[model samples]
Target: MKPSTGRQKALAKALTALIPLAPFSDAEAIREAAGQRKLRELPPSIAVWIATVAHVRHEHSDYDALLDEGYDRDSARHFVIDQMNAVLTTWRATRLVEGDEDEGE
Candidate 1:
């Protein structure tokens, strides 16, 4: 595998910092950090991992909805991740077709 580049490393570092915040947010920083394209620029898996962890930690509706649908917490998490992956794949494919290598700003 290729070595991680500076931006890739930065992405990792950002996640390291952001993750501890999980369910809490400071408005300005939260807006700024999330507004930065870096979050979206991270590899989809990593991005989804962060989102899932945060959502699960906060017990967001997405996670709860699975429980409402009869999935146990463990099963719900797996189900959400699988669904996220499918959607992410479709989004990437759509971006490729649009010829905009960047997913978006």
Candidate 2:
């Protein structure tokens, strides 16, 4: 899958802002702090996780949707990290296909 685009960022920001006004504008900041990417494709689980974080900060309708979908706290957390790793690996594979070699490999 392609990396999350600027449109995604804007939508995420708008949705997050409506949720409850997170202390931060970009949730990716938190992901990066967790050693994740700032902008990349995410699995549904991770997307839920990111949305959950925003929701926990401010439970809006969208967040409610995630909860309604049966996302538990543990799952949400795990999903974020797992999704990040998955995205990174996929990105690396894509780079390889594009003729980009791994550094020193």
Candidate 3:
């Protein structure tokens, strides 16, 4: 519906860089521990974000829900981080497919 903004592009580049850091190893740790479970290779779609629905929709974070339901704490965090990364990935993907429609020569 809209073109990807500069911010979105920059963020995509950043997340794309972090793709190599998936499943963080002991040598490269995140917030809690070094040897925790690795994250998904692709970003998690935590919520059902419709590209053509009322501009935006409210979707709850699956990660938080998991945390509340006594799920694996580390895994929940990993998914949350993945989802954040997904925002950028999503932007890039959407743009590569449809982002140019809004642009003018």
Candidate 4:
């Protein structure tokens, strides 16, 4: 295998630090995915965010099944927002949804 690029190594380190509460297998998988060629083009923070959100959406929520059941994309996302946010909270990542009082901030 090719040696990892500096960007890949840095992204992996950032992801590990960002999601310390995530399970070992999940955390490693997210880091591996974030180091992919496409994601490496983005800023590390944004890549990490995307990878984490995707992991939560697919693994921690019913998003795929909702889509399979014919829920529209937006509606499926809305239905799983709470479950997604709960996983985010557990991992100490920023929650995607906010309460009304958080809106003005």
What local lDDT does model 4 show for residue 83?
93
Tens digits of per-residue lDDT for model 4 on 1-105?
222888777777677667768887888777777777778778886677778777777899998999999999778777888998888778886446543211100
Q: Ten consecutive residues with minimal summed lDDT in candidate 2?
A: 96-105
RMSD, candidate 4, Å: 5.2
Which residue window of length 10 is worst by lDDT in model 1? 93-102
Query: Model 1, range 3-41, lDDT digits (tens) per residue?
Result: 166554554454434343332342223333433465666
lDDT of 4: 0.73
Find the candidate with the highest TM-score and give its number.
4
Clash pairs of candidate 2?
Answer: none
Q: Identify the leading candidate in terms of lDDT.
A: 4
Q: On a 0 to 1 TM-score scale, where does candidate 2 land against the true structure?
A: 0.23
Give the TM-scores of the predictions, in the order they appear: 0.31, 0.23, 0.25, 0.80
Q: How accurate locally is residue 105 in candidate 2, as Cα lDDT from 0 to 100? A: 5
Which ranges in model 3 have alpha carbons more than 4 Å from their true place? 1-60, 92-105
Error of 1 at 48 (Å): 7.6
Judged by whole-model lDDT over C-alpha atoms, candidate 3 comes out at 0.31
Whose TM-score is higher: candidate 2's or candidate 4's?
Answer: 4
Instruction: Report every candidate's CA lDDT.
Output: 0.42, 0.37, 0.31, 0.73
Per-residue accuracy of model 3 over 59-79 as CA lDDT, tens digit each: 323655776778785555445
Q: Candidate 3, 21: how far from true, in Å?
A: 23
